[model samples]
Target chain A: MPQPLRYLQIFATFARNSLIRDMTFRANFLIEFISSLSWVFMNLGFYILIFHYTPSLGRDTGWGKYEFFVFTGTALMINSLAGMLFMTNADNFGELIRRGGLDFVLVKPVDTQFLVSLQRVDWSSSGNFLVGLGLAVYSLRCLGVWPSPVTIVLYVFYLLCGVVILYSLMFLLAATAVWLGRNETLFDFWFYIVSFGRYPMEIYEGRFGRPFRWFFTFIIPVLVAINVPSRFLVQSIRPQSLEEWLLPLYTIAATVIVFAVCRAVFQLALHSYRSASS
Target chain B: MAAIEIRGLSKTYRVTRKKEGLVATLRALFRPEYEYVHAVRSIDLTIESGEFVAFLGPNGAGKTTTLKLLSGIITPTSGEARVLGHIPWRRENAYRRRFALVMGQKNQLWWDLPAAESFHLHQQIYGIPPDQFTRVRDELTEMLGVRQLLHRPVRELSLGERMKMELVAALLHSPQVLFLDEPTIGLDVVAQYTIQQFLREYQARTGTTVILTSHYMKDVVVLCRRVVVIFDGQIIYDGSLTNLVDHLGDYKIITIRFSDGQVPTDLSRFGKIILREPPRVRLRVARNEATEVIRAVLARYIAEDVSVEDPPLEELIAALFASARNSRLSQERGNSAVPEDTTHSANH
Candidate 1:
């Protein structure tokens, strides 16, 4: 079989395994679904609180677009990325590598990087995904921005870019297990970064913060998940000169670059994994 | 052509020599001197396809390091190895897909889920087609008698059950090459035999190339046709089990049953006595003098019954290691015949 076909086969197999994994614990899925739904409602209340204190983001106020502001951007971004993959899935790979559980992947005839990254998925997070998309649609109706077919396509493309960026960044961090030996703290550090993704990048300002934001821009570009989709909703928004071609193109380009770098690092790391003796 | 070829395979590990403590760890973190432990010295090996080979060694003998190099788990520091005509460390997906490595101490199964769930996940990871997947699963689980154990969570299974389940998981994809490290560790005798039987049958059916490392002699003796003995990061012996026993077991065991209340004569000059009780005298006699020794003992003691037999493989292995270590000690001490402690393992 062609190599590309094999990659797709591996991907499909991982995805199918994820489905079986979720079905394996039918009861846990229900409990987790309820827990995720409750978290979504709690976040929506937090979203409403953000606009309540700032009239600039309140309905009918001068900059009145809280519905568009909150859902199409911050709240929607959180929910969408939450379901793309679990934070634990990234952490588990590192632990697996340290524990020698990853030898199974090394001996198999599949891309270790692909198998490691996509092998496991937390199905419970699909609850967060569904709720987030529902809220995004409801808020879009409230803003009277139903999205043209073109905007919808762009939304998916950017969303995919955002997901890829996050996955690649986390994978690269997990790949550090080969060198660092224990990537537990690093895995937690990435999830901590994900928490920061819940807000717009404009909130923080520091000379050092620019590099921090650069991570979301040049490195992972979670900014694309929010800023681009928000542009489709805000009527007054305009693509500043180069931002038009540059942002999406950079998002796509960055995804490819991060994935390529990850693949290279992963191969280098595999060379270093002397199997555990104890 | 060699299906697997390793030339001058060497591995060195950077290990901290200090004991673990807060003070020691902190100081070591900043300016620690890492001792380069040569886990595997320059070693050469060529294994043909479909060979059931045992890679045996005492603790830290570099047998596992060699397997790691062969399976692409680790790169040799200053050597080259090829498995199925590919550089292992490159880890081409094609290469990985064709082989499976099972570490006895570590598990590949999901902890909280049934073993079947992990198997399904494995199927997807290997991209085993549905029909082949079903056939392999049914046939392997059937042969291994793990059909009843499949639905239970791996954490809930006994160690033996878990080991059996691990084999099913490893072989479910039908890997042409298998690297098994102490696969029968922590298993009951029956479970070990069950696994050995499955491995023999699997090898016979698929012609899979196997490289197994174990402290257990039965696993190597029963499953492997060829044995490679490694000591101190070198392949000292590479041949067959019968040859191993024959070459090292050149002495026969003499157990003489004599009449009660009779002390046996000082027969130390004749041979090395291994055992002496009230009415039993065991001697280690050369193969050529066994008949004469037995006649001499029987005539002298009016023995009830005398038996002569070959030593156990374990005993021969122990003697081989003891003599090897003794020779090395003599060399190190400049032929002083150093009176070193031999009450314990000479290799130790």
Candidate 2:
């Protein structure tokens, strides 16, 4: 078998093993799944109550009730994908470093980054992802917008781009654990940054909001993650000008660049690692 | 060819110094002080293929650090080493696939998963064929007497049982070189004996080169023919185990039993009285003077039985470390008048 195919096979094995491990604690898994879905439902309910007073998020931004739901759904999908794939592993990376558990990982013949990032799979997070996708489809129907096959394909592609961006960002934060010894606030910081990406980018148009929007859009590019994918779903909300079309292209480009940079940073961190002993 | 070779291998670490109190903690956040700790000093040694060598040292004497350097878990600050002609720190996949390192305190097995699952993971990581994997796995588990616990979660196993499983998992790849850092640590007497017996047999059968570090002298005495004693990050002694006892252990214990159940008051004239019981007394006699001391004792007192034996390896090693430490302290104090005895003992 080829090298890449062998890695995929190993990943499948890890997923299966993780499933078995999770199944051993059936009650805990169920509680986590239900709690995560409840959070998503509460967020949806909060937005629905807010839309009752205001017809749209912005006076002329066209982010009415259903359009905003699409954006919220896109945010949920991206966050859930990231939470399933790398959240738990990233959260535990510091403990592994401090306790010298990484010694075993380093000695293995497989790629250390691949093994650490994908070793654990949380099946509970998949529940939120499925609900998010359902909301996206439901909202699109409520708006009476039947997107063409091409538009749906583009939306899915951009959704994947959002997940890649979030994964790279969280991975970079986790890699800091190697240098800092313990980054206990990584999840809190990540949540704070990601919460900004939950709503439409046009909402940040005030004096402080303009700079915040510009910074997050160009520097971190979290705004483009949900905005481009959600906008592509509705005809009226889609990019009208050629410059607007560049947003999706820019999201792809930023994802590639950020992923490459994060991978390099992780390698550098490993090189500088001194095993836990003196 | 030598299975392992080293040239002035050294590892220095920068350790941050933290002072107590809130003020110091706050100040450290801005500027921290660091001290250089030479965990492994420049030392050189070599071991031939299929050699079973014991690495003996006191706590914090750099035994585990040296093993870590050899296993490529941490890079050295200077110097070089090669195992089977491959630079260890380079950590090539082909090299890693041929060697294994097991640390007693640190576990490689997944806590929530069964040991068998971890064994399968190792199979994939090492790229072992299915048939060979099963064969090696069964053989190792059988030898370790852990075949029944293969499917049980690792967190539920007893320490000894878990350690057996760890050994089995490590050997599943059939690694050519094994670096065991305190492999029998924290095990009961029976468990330690079991592991030692299995290791002895396994090394004999496979001709695998093994370097083991242990505080348990029994592990060394039972399995290793050659011993390397390290002190203060340097090789202090390297030779056969018998030679080690002869070189460092200059005294033997002589136990005497009185026929009439009477204690001798002046037995100190024979040798150093180490112990005394109702009808039995023990004396520490110099190795060269044992025969004369026994002769004098026999002539002076009517003894029913007598036995002469070397001091336990544990005691001998502790004495050696104490002597080494004293000499180092004297040297540090610039006490030129104090003669250094450790060098002379090693030469003998």
Stretches off by above 4 angstroms in model 1 are A1-36, A57-86, A202-220, A235-245, B19-24, B127-131, B148-152, B258-281, B302-304, B323-348
lDDT of 2 by residue, B1-348 (tens): 899999999887777787999999899888997766777788899999999999999988899889878877788989989999988777788888989988899899989999999999888888889999999998988888989999999999999999999898889899999999899889999999999999999999999999999999989999999999999888989999999999888899999999999988998987899889969999998889999999998998899999999999999999889988998776655644446532221111
Chain A accuracy of model 2 expressed as TM-score: 0.95
User: Worst 10-residue stretch by lDDT in candidate 2 chain A?
Assistant: A234-243
| Model 2 bad stretches (over 4 Å) | A235-238, B335-348
Tens-place lDDT digits, model 1, residues B1-348: 777888988887877668588998898889885667777878889999999999877778787778788787777788888889989888787788788888888888877678887888777667778899889898988998888888888889999889888888888888878899899988889999999999999999999999999888899889998998887677888999999988988889988877774647787766898887867878898988989987777677677777889898778777777776676667656634545642222222
| Highest DockQ against the true fold, candidate | 2
The most accurate candidate by TM-score is 2
DockQ of each: 0.54, 0.63
Model 2, B218: alpha-carbon shift in Å?
0.6
| TM-scores for every predicted model | 0.86, 0.94
TM-score of chain A, every prediction, order shown: 0.82, 0.95
Judged by lDDT, which candidate is best? 2
